[model samples]
Target: MTTADLHTLTGAYALHALPEDERREFERHLGDCEACTQEVRELSATAARLGLAVAETPPRELRERVLREITTVRQEPPAHGRRGRTVTTGRTGRWSGYALAACIAAAAAFGGVAVWQNQVAQDARQEANQATRQNEQLAQVLSAPDAKTTSGELTGGARGTVVVSQDRNQAVFLASGMERPPSGKVYQLWFNDEGTMRSAGLMNPAASDDAVLLDGPVDRATGMGITVEPAGGSAEPTSDPVALMDFPTA
Candidate 1:
């Protein structure tokens, strides 16, 4: 490839889309070309971040569509031909093939980046929406006219609290210094109805110190309790309560 062509391949090189032979040539050129090397580095870092931006899996239809196109897309022809075929001289024919391929690869790299950019933006918006919903739920319980707060000490000197709003039929659980459960286990919240226990929800492992809105209505439960249970939580508590707090009397 020509010097100009090699320069144009920086994006393609960063994306690893160049064929084997051209990729080796580009690597050797990178050692002497400072500009190309810097461009490659920036593009590579952007690519890595985009890869991690989305957690949802791609749809199967997208994969199948791409596979179908691969079969029908016509590949570029070779730059030179057999002795019997006409061969144009100079850049018009010999170098045109390589240049065309390099340009296409560069375009593909930019297109891929664009698609990732859109996906990342969508993921960010979705997370923001979820956070907003959670905040609203917490606010409802905290601001209710009948809201009552109860505190208790958890195992290992941790602290736990519940903000119950009977009028709204909602409650929020808060914890501080709550350590992660051991492997194969999780922390679960429960509604204590007299002597019977009903599962409230599994405590979030990601944020041990954050407030969590209880999963179900406070209903007739007189108090809340926490227990260590197997991962995914149990239908019923199988262990002793680590923490319990009874709601204040009316």
Candidate 2:
């Protein structure tokens, strides 16, 4: 085989998918070709990482499908060597067919695992970016020289604090020792602008200690409040205030 053709087979060889005759020929080439040897090693390591990334259960019919294909397929005779004689398979042909089938199944499974791992990594990256944005928003509020903090107790034995920026255009709310809301209900935050109440955001009830960056136009709000509302929250206060704290305008 030409060196180029042998080079193309490096991946198949690394995956153990090459036929025995071709495998032996490739091994001979490996002895004198340092580049091919390094290529094969790197490909083999990549395949190993693909396999270990995720545990996959092969399809139940994989073996049956392989055996079925083998029954209908014909094997090619080995290439003639320098002595001009074809290599004889003898009784090993049957085992070699099964080995080829297993290799194919393994390769397919690894391909699926690599895709799954890629998606998992992408999701983790998105979550990290979201966290970074939240932190940046909170830092803006905390570092402002005109920042003010106020604390209050809620109806359900929960306590919370609100940190408002100088311009009151941004704020952060932190809650602790809060009980999980009853089913079909959620904790909702509101900004009291004059006598009008506007929705800020919803809170996760299960968290014992939670922090959220409040949506803005907060400078217009004279105070902030929390209430238990329906799952999706309400446009206006659906229940009396569970907690209320005034924002220092001065």
Candidate 3:
């Protein structure tokens, strides 16, 4: 594989989803590349945390279907007697037993694959539902009768806007020409209440321009601010804000 292709395998490698040959190749690459190694480590940790999510029980109908299918599978009688001597009927009987075992192994493998696919489908559905809900909330704020919008300038000539609705108690932040943040740091939003600042959330570092719905209610917040903070963010601002948008007086 090309170097770029190998780099993209960090996630799959972290999840142990790579084929044996590809996994070995990636592991050898990992020994020399620091960035891929770090990424794989982080992805593995994130995967571990996500694994803690509660798994849903299979549907009753699915269980019943499996049970019914089980009844149709032929059972193999013991090949050995109580005296521990082989009790083979003939050469055909031994071959039949081998074929049955192979069928059973294949069925078991397919069953595992089915379960994994179902889990992946469930995770996708949950993520889609979450994104839908967020979009609905953003629409409410943007379409509110009392919503007001304001714009401001960020450092390095970038610009952003804040659209807030007192009735909805929500706000949406939109930015343009945003540069990538310095390594190990993130662009964080804050709810500027009077003189105090509360963390709204972190912006997508990779997005040059994006709309973000602020994380909390706009209650009594006179303005919004964006600051560069360490990754994962801080409880309080550690540096001057790159941009600040003051809400109009009510």
TM-score of each: 0.52, 0.52, 0.57
Worst 10 residues of 2 by lDDT: 86-95
Which one wins on TM-score?
3
* Backbone clashes counted, model 1: 0
Model 1, residue 23: what's the lDDT? 58
User: Considering TM-score, where higher is better, how would the candidates rank from best to worst?
Assistant: 3, 2, 1
Best by lDDT: 3
Give the backbone clash total of model 2.
1
Cα lDDT of model 2 by residue, 1-250, tens digit = 6654465455445544455466566665665565665666555555434422333445869845753443233333322211343332211222234655675578677776566446645543443344345544666676567878888786667788777886648887777667756655767889988878898876643344556667566867888888998765688998888888888656
Expressed as tens digits, the lDDT of each residue in 16-37 for candidate 3 is 4445576556655665566665
| Per-model RMSD to reference | 19.4, 24.7, 17.0
Candidate 1 residues lying further than 4 Å off, grouped into runs, are: 1-116, 206-208
Relative to the true structure, how large is the alpha-carbon lDDT of every model? 0.62, 0.60, 0.63
Q: Positional deviation of 189 in candidate 3, in angstroms?
A: 0.5
Supply the global lDDT for candidate 1: 0.62
Better of 1 and 3 by lDDT: 3
> For residues 1-250, could you state the per-residue lDDT of candidate 1 as single tens digits?
7665566555444443445476567666665665665565555545433322323445989745754443233223222232344322221122345655675578687777566446645543443344445555666677677878878788888787777888888887777667756655667889888978988876643233646677788889998888988656788998988888887556
